[model samples]
Target: MKYRFVIILLSILILSSCEFSQKRYKPDWDKWKNYKWILNKNVRNNINSGFTLYKKNANFNLIRYNENNQLVIWEFKHHNYVSIDSINFFENIDLSNFILYPGQTFNKEDILETSVRINSDLDIDLHLNLNSDSKIYEYINKDKVKGIIGKVSQMSLSDETGYHQVLFDFPIRSYNVATLFFKRDDSFFILILFPDDGLVKDKLKDLNLPELNE
Candidate 1:
């Protein structure tokens, strides 16, 4: 009788928690996905303005207009990095040759090499396992991959001097990923998933995996 009562209480608690979470986030997923944003005034004025990207099965489209007002859409396959630009120009140099493992210690050269193409040659530092733990990987449930870590800069293209700010997150390693674009001060900023150490890197070729659409 005691064990049965405990199970009933636990079941009620789990159901209540689920109900609370759903009410808290009352998310309109469809509206968030398909809403055509008008973008800000600064974004409209740039030469790269009127650009839009829509993701498809296994690829994405980079859509823009030519001088004639005709649409030019370039479809690029979503694949892993072939070289340094795939990561960041700065992080690319050393990464091309070096093989990184989980829980490994990073050195001075690692810092220097990773900061090369970021923020106009500005140097970046890494703090292992304390402030920003590189060894600990986060699994972002939405994208179904290991979490990301590193500093991302969003800059304006019209005025080279204008930029928004830098965001830092960790372990530069997984697979399932998503990249979102935002325009600030007439510059474009992209939020991309950085791989964490896991089965993702090992099984990247399994391209037909399901997305979190449900």
Candidate 2:
């Protein structure tokens, strides 16, 4: 009976450790090879439905969703990149003539979408729920991107309550971005878009684009 008690204690300790480890906020930054094209499984059931994001007619031509946990890093150019998955979400992006160009890389600058497991260890929930406006602005300001005040709106996606924002200027302010966050069970997915080289900084202000919610 004494031996059985010891074994039970050890099992409890192991389970507690596993739970703590899974809840930690250690983000995986490196590993670009895990990024995958949406043509395979990310697409909708219809053959006519192309491999674009939840929106339509945006300058964000080339799009790719990351299959792994790490955030997709833009290899070159001045496209905006989000480091923290919790703060950056997706919404309104403009369509462009951008496509697989001769010189530009394919997967790097395209649409980056990834789902992160929601847990208390990352403090993502705290920042998102408690004073999210201040936290988001603080992070974006730290990136040296000025006048980027994102107003998050709640939207429904297939029976799920998702967060939406248009022209989310983060990590990079030069590019107009659309990001969306949807909670599926215990995890939330973020979809971010970057315009092609043809859409320059000078033209962004002039274009009157529609929000993804429309």
Question: Per-residue lDDT of 100-205 in model 2, one digit per residue for the tens?
Answer: 1211122233233222222212223212321222222222222222112233221111101222111122222233333333332233334333343322232223
Candidate 2: stretches off by over 4 Å: 22-27, 32-214
lDDT for every model? 0.25, 0.28
Report the Cα lDDT for candidate 1: 0.25
Clashes of 2: 11
Clashing pairs in 1: 90-117, 149-169, 149-170, 156-187, 173-195, 173-196, 174-195, 174-196
TM-score, one value per model: 0.19, 0.25
Judged by whole-model lDDT over C-alpha atoms, candidate 2 comes out at 0.28
Top candidate when judged by TM-score against the true structure: 2
Worst 10 residues of 2 by lDDT: 52-61
